[model samples]
Target chain A: MSTIFAHGGQLAHGVLLTMLMTVLGFGCALVAGVVLAVFHISPVPPLHRLAVGYVAVFRNIPLLVWLVLFVFGLPEIGLLYPLFGTVTAAMALYWAAFICEAVRSGIRTVPPGQIEAARALGFGFSQLLRHLVLPQAVRSMVQPLGTVFIALTLNTSLAAAVGVRELTGETQFFTITYDIPIPAFAVTTAIYVLITLAGGLLTGRLERKLAFKR
Target chain B: MNTGASTLFDLPGPAGRRRIRIATVVSLLLIVVAVVAVVRRLTTHGMLAADEWRVFTQWPTIRFLLGGVWATVLVTVVAMAIALPAGALVALVRLSRARVARALGRAYVEVFRAIPLLLLLYMFLFGLPRLGLTFPVFWQLTLAIVLNNAAVFAEILRAGILAVERGQSEAASSLGMTYWQAMWLVVIPQAVRKVVPALVGQSVRLLKDSSLGYVVSYLELLHQSQVLGEYYHTVLPTYLVAAVVYIAINITLSRFAHLLENRGLRGVRRRRHPESTALAENAAIGSGGRAPLIDDSTV
Candidate 1:
């Protein structure tokens, strides 16, 4: 316990980095994911196929493999980014595929009747999307997106693999240096639990606020 | 179910058809251009050098990598064997009438689910040795994965158990069955069947996670590829091949889950909202665990 308190500053930095990565990664994922979802459901056939292929390829691969590839392999082709930037980008690219699916699923929740009603009212494609589909779809998406965010937060630990010194890395440092594995791990686990609990609560609140009323 | 694209847009009139056709062609051309540029860049960097890939054709190299695949499968199989039954037990405990049991179960699932698998693996790999409690490297990786995945499987199984209609267990009780007997005989089997697709989906995650064996020097596929790449001095190409291999195996598993869903084997409760149902499937697909449970609060 003393060991944990002694390293409180390091742990705090780890938590901050992990949070930064999750937020940045999720932001990138959101933009790419929404675009992919639109392309997936767009009237354009080839773009739909491209989106399908993109999700399949990215979603199927492991996050660690993607990170290693980006961190180590990309330099062979002259595309170099900082270690932190590269890992976050890899995470964003990988998770964007999942977010695309979540968004697509959210869109599907907008009932066929609602869509038909919009068509009957002579709404154009863009207007239907803006006025009817996206609003409700975005509402339904909140919970799932929250789930994705939590998962991303946990995954940010993998950034430690490429030398990000996130929560997991800091925990390792404490354990090795102080020879207090139990205290080190327990403190880190508690911090992670707190992070996830906070995320879940915030998401539940947002989900309720955004929920569509009949 | 309706195809999402078709539902999003009206059936094309002649003008719409023409527009779609032009859009398709334009998108195809853009994709082709992107591909060409990527290929050109790789060529310029000598990344596409034929000799770098030639190792794949050799029987010895192929055999070596297959050994890695076998090791990965072995780890995944052993971990799954332990995790599946353990997860069921955890799920049953969470469903127990005793509040203490439920809390303990929830704590187990929530903690493991919250902690990343790599951190757990590191604890096993590095921490336990200091306590003079070392297992073989294989058990270290496999057990770490089991700890995390058992919690996940518990959540998936709990979802299935809850999805089973309440009346089924009530009927079993009316027939003079004990609560445990009803759960074991009537409820659990049906629950397992309902969530088999989700279970398969989780297995894909397990299989991909087995690749983390690379971190512990377990000589899994990625590790083997890394060694091979070092031997041939073609690290990027080797990792790409390994990535392709991981993608191929996971894609097959994911497709199986989709097949099960499409065959109407998802669960007993038919979700009224298409978004809810889709999110459920996406939960299995996307997240580590926490698969949009019957009651989301439990997570």
Candidate 2:
């Protein structure tokens, strides 16, 4: 294990990729979720329906379905990302549905009186959403959204199915190459466990801080 | 997770309604254009052909897939069987009086919950050969799924346990019951009832996750779909079929769970609310378990 780490073996690289994918996928989920949530709550009936339909389809379909479909179907639509990119993109889309739900619910936590006040002050739709609604919505969202993103951390390993040499793939590759399956698996598993524990703790702390500020 | 009666602004006036109508038309146009682009290409490739779907009725393919469904169900049943009880025990350990027991229980839940189910599956399936205990694909996959879910179940059960009023336990102890007696006879049963919806959600997750067994060559429903693809030289059709199967099974499972939950809810005589703890539990535990595609809380 020490030698593998010292030489930056496949397992090490895989662990690195896993964390990278989590951060990247999580960022995409956040942005896409905010967009979808905005459309969902927008006064425009068609835009709201479109967003609702988006969440319905994406959320109903399993991540595996999107991963497989994007791999096989994207080129037909004239989108051509590599295996890793496709997997990450699909994950972001899948997670965005859940994030949209969290964000929508968070927006609900913003009192109706607040919206009325903003309207009375002549705040436009965009201005009200940007200046008034989003700030408070985000605060309520911090904990639930944190939990969802932490789940994203584990789902990153699913990328390995489409031939991304993330942690799981790396674990298999290193195990095969070094003929040290037990140690390789043990080490990679431990790293993920530690990361998950840390994420949960960090989110809890963040939630507390947000609560205190409120 | 379930957003109730929420709107961004007041109902639109006449002018506002006109804008909304225009926005609807524009959104529909965009969606139609995108859908057409994809459909046109698929038609060009013969992917939309009725002939490709006839294989769904073929005995060889259907039987193979049916076998896969059984495999998926078997995995779910076995994992749930072990994980549920084991999770409860772990929850007890988490709430144990002993510091070491609590720490060890916490470590177990944290570790298993953190690791991806697929990676854990790989670790057990591939790594076990090095430990002189290679399991059949079934056992290996089951072990991974059970371990992964048990940690999460433990946490959920722990929360449910905590949610039970402390006074109940106090009353039990004051009545000359031992701590174990109070927990066994009083606390656990109530906790389980309160969290039935969450447990049901987890069970469905175990079913869906069993599809991951395909990676290890478990010949589960997803793998059988791949087998159909291999023979037919068509990937999307086979995958779509598999997804349909998964969706159907999950829908049924959740429906049954809801039925059971409704009966329980009625007996408990809880106040009826549109948004139950079920959705909230689904969202929170789903962060750790499987996500429901449609809002199950609507049931």
Candidate 3:
């Protein structure tokens, strides 16, 4: 226990960094994902195709591969960024595909009758989306978006591969220094579990509050 | 085509078609510009040089990477094989009447699900060696993957089991079947069928996790690329090739999952027409709402 406490400051810092990366990654993903999703469903043929290709490429590759590629490949092209920025960018790019799909699926959940009702009521594309589709879709989107965020948070642990010194990386240092790998990792694992559980609880409450009850 | 109905919009009018045509042209130009710019950057950096990529044409490099692919498949298959039965057992335990058994099973699932696979990989790679129970690197990676995926599979299987109509099991009990017999004969098989797509999705995840083999010196596909990158001094291109390979494999897996999902929908259609013979039972088996995978927690 003393061994664990001795690294309290490091653990705390690691947690902060982990949260920082999650927030940053999710922020970028939200913007990019929403844009890509708009492109996906829009009438513009080329943009829709572009969105399809983007999602396919990003979704099918592993997050670690993207990180390694960005970390190493970008520097080769003289586009050097800090390790934190590089890892966050890779994560955002990878997860944007998931968020885009979630948003598209969320839109799908809007009843066909509602869409037909709007169309019959003489609403244009923009008006129908603004008044009917988005309101319902965004509500349904909260749960899936929340799931993506949790997965993103779990993925921040991969930042340790690029030497971000986040929770996992800090745990690695503590384990080596103290020669107590199990206890060190156990503590790290507990911290991660707490983060995800808290996320789950919060998302559940928000979903209940926002549910589209008749 | 049903695509017109399936999308958010109706078929476009003349004005809408003209607008779409113009937008398509402009976007096409923009995409072309972006692609050209990226290619130019690569060319300038000599990143696309023929000499740099020549390493891949050699038979030895292909063989090496193939070995890595084989290692990755071996790990994924072994981990999945162990996880399926272990997860079913855990699901059964969680579904048990005893409160202690349920609580223990829930704890196992929750703990494992919340933890990152990488952290677990590290624990297996480094922590276990300290306890005088060191295994080979491949086993180390495989065991970590098994522990994590078994928890996820347990959740998925449990959802499938619960999604089953309660009446089926009750009828089995009324027919003088023991609890275990009812579960084995009536419940578990249907549960497995209902969640086969979700299970395939989990397999995609496990295959991805096998890339963590890089961390433990396991020489899986990703690690092999790293080694090739070092040897050829073509880090970017080698890793890019490996990334493409990963993408191709995973896309094929996801496509298979999609095929299974569509086949279930076809079963639904056959039920609607009532001309279905064996498909009536398939429709019944596939009728439940999709089972919740670990990442898709509505529970």
Candidate 4:
């Protein structure tokens, strides 16, 4: 207990880094997911094929492999960066594939007639997407999106392998430094549980509020 | 629905006109660049360069990775085997009239689903050893996978059960069947058909997630690949091979799921139409001031 309290500042820093990675990864996932989803549902055959391949490649490979590739491989070919950017970009790219699939399904749940009606009302493609399709899809996608967010949060722990001082990495560092593995990881696990529960509650509340109008 | 009437000229206005043009141009440009890049890479690094291809011919590493693949398959199959029956039981408990069972089942699902698989892996792998109750690494990894998947499978099974129409149960009961018999014979078969696709998808996810066993020093495919990369100093090729293997397995599983979904849809279509028509007619009669005549007593 004394040792853990002694390392409280390190634990706090670890928790903060974990939250930063989660938020950054998830934000990138949302933007990339939307783009990929649109590409997938586009009418062009080649675009659809490209989107399908992207999802397949990312989803099938383990996240660890992708992180290693970006962290180690990219620099070999001359694209070098800070460890944080490399890991974050890789995590975002990997999870974005899943997010794309979820978002595409949400888009499919929207009635086709809604888009048709927008078209009939002289709405441009952009206008129709912004005004009609996206709002409805966003509302319907809350649960799956939340699931992806939680998954991403857990997965960011993989960044520890690349030397990112996230929660898992920090705990490992403290364990080795202080010769106390159990308490260090226990506290780390508790912090993770707390963050995930808070995220779940916030998303659940948002889902309910969004549904009230319906 | 005059499909032919809406030609390009018939589209409403100039609102979409410029946007469509810009989208087309940008997409074409992206496609060209992508094609060029692929062609350049393939030509520069031929399909079978000695440096890239030599890793597979290394007997020891290949053997290790193959062994790891078998472990992955075994873990996935065993976990799914355990989870399916357990999930069905939990689903039944959730749907049962017993209040305590329902609460217990719901709590199981929520707790397991809320916890991350990695944390559960850590608990079983490291935490239990501290309590002086240790499992072999394989069993530890398998337990973690099974527990995580069982929670997801329970949800899938519950949704499947809920999809079974109420009339089917009533019909089975009218024929003097017990609740369990009706559930087993009439309801579960239909429910399984509805959820088989989702079950396969989850199984694929389980297979992928098993790679996380690397964290616990389990010698799965991902771990083996990492070992090879560390040995040869060629991380990219080893991982490329691993990624290809995973893609192959996922595609195969997805294809099987597609086949099952098609078969289930056909079966449902064969049975649903007549029953739906009859129910519609009966509903009309009841709304027109006639009793359902089958009676509340029969239920």
lDDT winner among the candidates? 3
lDDT of 2 by residue, B1-299 (tens): 22322445656789888987888888889989998987898788787889877888889878888998899889989999999999999999999999999999988887788878988878777777767888888998898899988887898789878978899899999999999999999899778876666677678767867878768888888777777777887678788778777777876787777766657656544654535446434434433223333222111
- Cα miss at B50, model 3 (Å)? 0.6
Off by over 4 Å in 2: A43-46, A72-80, A110-133, B1-7, B270-299
Clashing pairs in 2: none
Q: Per-residue lDDT tens digits of candidate 1, residues B1-299?
A: 22544666888999999988999898899999999999998999998888879999999999998998889789888999999999999999999999999999999999999988889988897778878999898999999999999998999899889988899899999999999999999898767765765577578778888888878899999889889888998889989988898877777666655666555524523634565456455544433222221123224
Q: What is the DockQ of each candidate?
A: 0.58, 0.45, 0.59, 0.28
Q: What DockQ results for candidate 2? A: 0.45
Alpha-carbon runs more than 4 Å astray in model 1: B256-299
Segments of candidate 4 deviating more than 4 angstroms:
A161-163, A171-189, A212-214, B1-28, B31-49, B57-64, B96-100, B165-177, B264-299
Clashes of each: 0, 0, 0, 0
Scored by DockQ, the top model is: 3
* Best-to-worst lDDT order: 3, 1, 2, 4
Q: Looking at model 1 chain A, which ten-residue stretch has the lowest summed lDDT?
A: A101-110
Per-residue lDDT of A1-214 in model 1, one digit per residue for the tens?
8767876899999989899999999999999999998888887878888898898788778888899899888898899999999999999999998898888878877888888888999999899999998898888788778888888898899888778898998888778888888778888888889999999899989988987677
TM-score of 2: 0.87
What is the Cα-based lDDT of residue A126 in candidate 4? 73
Pairwise lDDT winner, candidates 2 and 3 = 3
Candidate 4 C-alpha lDDT tens digits along A68-148: 778866654456899998899998999888888777656755666666777788877677778877787878678778878
For candidate 3, write residues B5-38 as lDDT tens digits.
Answer: 2456878889888988999999999999999999
Given candidate 2, what's the lDDT at residue A113? 83
- As for lDDT, the candidate ahead, 2 or 4, is 2
The CA lDDT of each predicted structure is 0.83, 0.77, 0.83, 0.73
Q: Give per-residue CA lDDT, model 4, range B1-299, as digits (tens).
A: 11111221235347556665667678889999988886566446443368766868878777888988887788788888998888888889989999999999987776676556766766675556766878888889888888877877888888877877999999999999999999999999877765565566677778887787677778888777878877877766777788888888777777765665556555655767776445434333221221111111100
